[model samples]
Target: MDAAQHISIYSSGNRQPDYSPLQSTLDRLKKRTEENKVTINHTNTVVMHFCTSSQAVAHPQLSVGAHSLQLVQSTRLLGVTVDDRLSWKQHVINIVRTASYKLYMLRRLKSLGTPAKELRDVYTAFTLPTLMYASPAWSSSLTLTQQQQVERTQKRACRIILGPAYDGYDNALTILSLPRLSERHREALGKFGRGLLCHPCHQHFLPPDAPPPRCATRHINKLVPIRAPKTDRYKNSAIPSIVHMINSV
Candidate 1:
């Protein structure tokens, strides 16, 4: 697929009542796609998920090459399920559902007298990845209940791997050399911040720092953006969390 052919538009707030611009843009895209010999599959449904904080606004009737796209409550984008609210609740729920099923399989294996090392390996290979996949992007938005739900999955995995002797969840995690889910989320955000500092593409947005000392052969300078005024939580979550973590260090 030609990367340039894929276009995405983001509109914010419920106050804007105009839809003329969006309709016009879609019309141009439809015409361009036709020029590029792209055929629209009218039989298939195209979903347009409108994300909002409150009740949905009225969407203008939209059609592309004889196919009218339907507005949906939620949709999957690049493997993550994004809902209308942008709360990430749906994504978290879906991950928990998947992790719970995986835990069931792990518990069954445990009953079969599987070795602790092997079970730990399985949990690390499967369950942890599921819980932590793209977590830095969504973890900050999770509610207390949702965070607990995700944490419980890991706690269970730790218990299974550490055997029945460990008395507390903390102890089990300590023995496993693992941090709590929340702490891990912060760590991931910190790492992401450092990665951005090291990348040339992000240098434009990152605040500049003083020049390195003359004696210092190598200087590691951490650059983080100043926090903007608080507004909507879901908007630009990753960068702000990254900034917070970087400033703390």
Candidate 2:
């Protein structure tokens, strides 16, 4: 599916302090739906996620019309599991667990005497995407443990394809001609930033034009810069860091 198909949002924050503004936002949404003759299934209740370090503040109950939404600590959006804290630990763990299972299948294929090239192709097709899916959007926020978890999966795949003899992570990867997981993630972020400038829908997110390039070769368009939000835990989790780097270049 296209990226736009996976977009998700909430009317407003679910915290007590946000109740007044949330109510107003909901009212506007309700009005727009009514005016557009759109139907909302009240049976499908809203789920709220609040990312907070403090456990002292209780989350207040919220409602849209008669439907009372459930407050959740984490929820799945698109294919990623997002925890309220934005740590992405759960998402990383989930993807790694899934990729591990695929690794087992790859091992079985290796036992069947699958050629190294075919095994590599199968791993790239089935397993690599799972570990790196939407990674550019989340990789920068990953803790070292999470990063290791992802890298371990790739390392295992490389071992499976190259056999137990080349068990060293670097050796297996070298035989496979695969870069480190961190390098792949960095490249993905760079490509994502470039893509933003190519897509019309994301143009508004770009900053103002850069000053004229010093050379004709550097005349390619540049992304606008956005300062990272001071309070955001996933400070570089999404667009800002990518755009920041692009603009700096």
Candidate 3:
């Protein structure tokens, strides 16, 4: 298949490379724990995770810079501890799992005749944000108890986000966070989501520091327009005005 051509992947072709940066971090953490690395014993890691993954998913092209920046800022509020991040082995594991999710989603979409780009867009919009977590902040390096809590929290979170994987970037989070959305936009969103596959609001707005979208249109939208604002990628010759039958709306 050519690079530009649509690759018919039926949940089997999506393969993300394994990039675990946690194992080495664990080794470092263990050494530090044994040697009393920095005298700081415990702090909240959920805060770091929440900030990092939240920013990453929010950005187009998955900005590691944004994720790391958020991670650093979070460390400031909670506590600065970059001692044991980027563990190699753990990153590899994450790669496999992330790949699995991608593959499954790809196959499902291909079967539905959904374009690869759309599949990528929808999944990136919905799944990535939900996967960003703030629980299970510790692992074997910390203690059995902390590891257990992290595990439980991770599992519970995955459960909450698994089935509704199709609903990319739940605007519901905004509803819960903003009172303005509550009064004016909440009800409209539910109606807006009625078979409304694309997310116009997301296309229009997102947190700053994201990458630029090549084109932001109904048919094809790549990135979320990071570098510039007020950019709209619309088709010049799209035919419209086709009336359709109402299907239980």
Query: Which candidate has the highest lDDT of all?
Result: 2
Report the C-alpha lDDT of model 2 over 1-249, residue by residue, as the tens digit. 322222244543434455656656666776786897765554454555564746454565666776776777777877878876767888988999999988988889989999998999999999999988988779877878889989988987887888856668887787788889899898898888777666667655556563333346847656545655776554566677776667667
Task: Determine which window of 10 residues in candidate 3 has minimal summed lDDT.
Answer: 236-245
lDDT tens readout by residue for model 3, 115-142: 5356546544544332232111111122
- Against the true structure, whose TM-score is highest? 1
How does each model score on TM-score? 0.80, 0.80, 0.19
- Please state the error at residue 112 of candidate 1 in Å: 2.4
lDDT of 3: 0.30
Model 1 residue 219 lDDT score: 51
RMSD of each: 3.9, 4.2, 22.4
* Poorest stretch of ten by lDDT in candidate 2: 1-10
Backbone clash total, candidate 3: 21
Candidate 3 has what TM-score?
Answer: 0.19
Model 1 misplaced regions, further than 4 Å = 1-7, 12-14, 41-56, 204-228, 232-236
Clashes of each: 0, 1, 21
